[model samples]
Target: MLRFAPSPTGDMHIGNLRVAIFNYIVAKQKNERFLLRIEDTDIERNIEGKDKEIMEILKKFNIKWDELLYQSQNINFHQNFAYKLLQEKKAFACFCTPQELEIEREKAKKEKRAYRYSGKCEEITIEEASKRAEPFVIRIKKPKSSIKFEDILKGKMSFDPNEVDSFVILRADGRPTYNFACAIDDMLHDITYVIRGEDHLSNTPKQIHIRKALGYTKDIIYCHLPIILNIHGKKMSKREKASSVKWLLEEGFLPEAIANYLILLGNKTPKEIFTLNEAIEWFDLKNLSNSSPKFDIDKLRYINREHLKLLQEEKLAKLLGYEDSQIGELAKIYLEEASTLNELKNKIDKIFNEKRDYKDFEKEANILKENILEVIKNSENFDEFKKELMKKSSLKGKQFFKPLRIMLTNQEHGPELSKIFPILKNKIEEVAKWW
Candidate 1:
């Protein structure tokens, strides 16, 4: 099984969607079970509605997990495994207080050396340590030799055992740290593949140690995905504008387009537009690049336009802020060149908003302005009126239609003059001939 674990701390950044996309696609390609587990161990940081909101977002993205779990539900289970390590002599309770550890850390800084935890409590007997009423946290005993594991994307990784100290497995408050909880849960869930962002590689050795200490012999694969970076070449921040999944959905981006952009973020697949199923068919760990993918908003807009072109007229009409069934005809004309629904809104806003300038075909626009009232005053057929107006003005080609376009829409280019006429309705007379 493969699992996606998200913390219910705040709004999910757009970057989070890629992790789910990779996991879901991997699960489908491998024909294995996919699961979702919410890591809500830090209750202090948990926000109300975040879990529900995340569920809705996943649903919106069409990511369906075979099994769903809450890490908070397994608190006792994790604590028991920690205690088991203590019983097996694979772990020990550290009685060092915060102040004592802080002093050692400061001393390490002053000595210009790395801070490895002093094994002050490593030799303490379990019975002796258990008898103490003072608060304590469990720490796994790091083996003295080098550790090695094979990453699916990055192969044959070796870690110096000295790089990691005897890190805490459980806090003094009896809650599992992220590494400890993740390891135990993976083992419990029988997860065969662990795919996630590359930043978590530093924590892998610690998790592997916990697994070995707990005697979990099952094989588990690891795949670290490349990250999405900001302009500074660091991980994209959640605070960045328009970075939240919720915000993008609210801004009228189709979920399919977001998925398309995300899959292509680091993979460099030739095809930029694809559905979720297509993405699954193309998902390959080997194709992923080690370099961080730059988040290109313009590329996202291009993807959005591709999706907009495929939308049904009724759906496009709704997205265009028009409920009129006739707007479907309008959608068909403008959406051909529009990149976003907002851009469509701007193009059509002139029908309802105040008019600006009409600079094109000045002489032809002048003729149309002078006689358009006379044409409207006497004729019921637009074809008859436009034919007569053009003949009377002795203009042809763009010189002829250009005036009609500028006089009606105030823009040099748009849908054919015939289509925009319906949008102008009775407001055409409001336009002055003086300009």
Candidate 2:
């Protein structure tokens, strides 16, 4: 099984959406059970209704799951297992108060050394602690040596036990800590692979230690996805103007394009435009680089323009809020330079009809005699009309159509004249006289 575990702490950022896409695609490709698990244990930090907002964001990306669950609902499940470890002597209760721990940390900082837990309560037996009836937290008893684990992506990584102390399994407040809770969930759920951002790389050895301490041997592998960076090469943040998925969709970015761009971010692919199925066929997650990948917004726009080409005229018309097929027709023509649907709207508005405001076409229009308007007003089809204008105006080539095109649409070069009149419905007289 694979799971997309996101903390409902804030708006689902673009990086989170990318993580979900990676996880969802892997699960889909393997035909495995995929699920969403909200790590809401840190409930105090959660924004109001963020859980609901997260769900909506996932749906917007077509990230469907087999089961939906919360870590909060399974609090006792994590709690009970933590106690089991405590009973097995794999973990022990700590009686050190916050002030005492802080003092030790301050002294360590003064000594210019790393702060590992003092293991103050290691000698204190559980029976003695229960007899005292004092409040305390559980800490896993990690050895004072190095811990090693193999990563599918980074390969053969090691961490010092001193680098990671015997971390708290249960907080003094009786809430199971993240590493402890996540380990229990993953083991119980039979998650064979843990595919998540490398931001969680530090947490891996800790979780691995917890599972090993539990005496259950399961070969659970991990694929640490690279961290997504912003344009400034910093971690993506809302303060950095890293857009949310909702905002991208609102800006008229195709969801397919967004998905494709996210997948391409530190992974290899020969082509830009691809369906999710194509993505699965092309992407090999184990071979992905461990380097941090910058979230290139410009690259996303380029890919969106590619997907825009795939859009059917009828569908493209509806997306632009146009009932006329001419808008879609002209949109495809303008979309060669369009990155998003809003840009398409601007381009479509340009040629859906002529520009009455900008009369830069006046100079171009002056070159064509008033007699050309008479021919244009009387002509039926575009071909016959162009012939009449050339014959009467005594002009041919760009000298003829170029000025006529400028007068009609106010653009130097644009949609074909044949397609234009059908779109504009023949206001050549108004166009010529107004200029």
Candidate 3:
């Protein structure tokens, strides 16, 4: 089994979704279970509807999970394991206060030294430690020897024994820390593969140590995916525009488009557009880019247009949620000539509702009226009308529609005349009233 655990802290960002996609692809291709785990151990930062939104987005992308688990619900299990480690002397409680730890950290920073707990309470007898009755955090006892592990993607990595921090397994409040909680959840869930961001690379060794201490060390794979960078070459964040999935969805990007573009970010193969099945078949951890991939809005738009073009006419209409009968009719005609569905929708949106006035078209409309009215009267068919008007005047669709469109809909561009003409042919005579 594989799992994608996300913290419910804010809106789901594209970077986070990319990680989920990788895990989904791996599990789906292997015919293994993919679980969704809410890493809400940081209760202070949890958002109310963020988890629901995340699940909804996953549904939108067709990312299925076998189980949905919350880390907070497993608190007791994590605490039990921590206590067992404590009894085995593999973990010990430290009564160091926040102020003392901060001072020690600052001193280490000033001295340009790596800070490891100085074992202030390492020798404190358990009885005396219990008698203190002071709030204390349980810390894992680090082995004197170095820790080494093989990252499936990055190969072998080694961390010095002294450099590793004696991290807290359980906080002073008796809540399991993120590292401990995640490890316990993975073990209990029988997750055979752990796929997450590269930022968690350093934490892998510590989790390995914990598994060893718990005597549950078996075959497990860890694949740390690369990070996604913003256009300016910085890590993408919600603070930046177009970084969040919600923002992108609002900007007219279809869910399939977003998922397709995200998959290409870190892993691009010969195939340009990929369906969910194709993604599952082609996705591999070894193929993920080592360097962070840049997120370009322009490229995203291009990819979206491609996906939009492939959608069925009815699907596109359903996706856009267009209800107007005329708009749907216009969409069919516009799509025939449009390079993509987005372009088709763009053209239809122009005249779907009341016309929007523009300054340039307002001035140009007056000069083009006499010629446009005569052309509209003379042409027998829509196709012939366009050709005749194009010959007499160099102006194409926009220029031709500018005066007539403004006269009727008060907009410069709109649904193709070929489409609008059939629906609004009666309105043409009414438009003639303005002339």
lDDT of 1 by residue, 24-121 (tens): 99999999999899999998999999999999999989999999999989999999999999998989999999999999999999999999899999
Candidates 2 and 3 compared by TM-score, better number? 3
The TM-scores of all predictions, comma-separated, are 0.85, 0.84, 0.86
- Quote the lDDT for 36 in model 2: 93
Segments of candidate 1 deviating more than 4 angstroms:
321-329, 335-337, 349-385, 389-435
Any runs in candidate 3 off by more than 4 Å, and if so which? 323-347, 356-380, 386-401, 405-435
lDDT string for model 2 (1-435, tens) is 989899988767777887788788888888899879999999689777888988887786778989888988888988888888888787899989989999999999999998789888987777887888779999999855676878888989999887668889898888999998899889888887788888899998888888878776887778888878887888887765445776788788998899888888887787867977788776778757788888888899999998888888888888898875656776887765678999888666554444544344354456575666677667777888888877777777766776777666666766677866755545444445445
Worst 10 residues of 2 by lDDT: 352-361
Q: In what order do the candidates fall by TM-score, top score first?
A: 3, 1, 2
Per TM-score, the best of the predicted structures is: 3
Each model's C-alpha lDDT? 0.81, 0.79, 0.77
Better of 1 and 3 by TM-score: 3
Q: Clashing pairs in model 3?
A: none
* C-alpha RMSD of each candidate structure in angstroms: 4.4, 4.1, 4.2
Which residue pairs come into collision in candidate 1? Answer: none
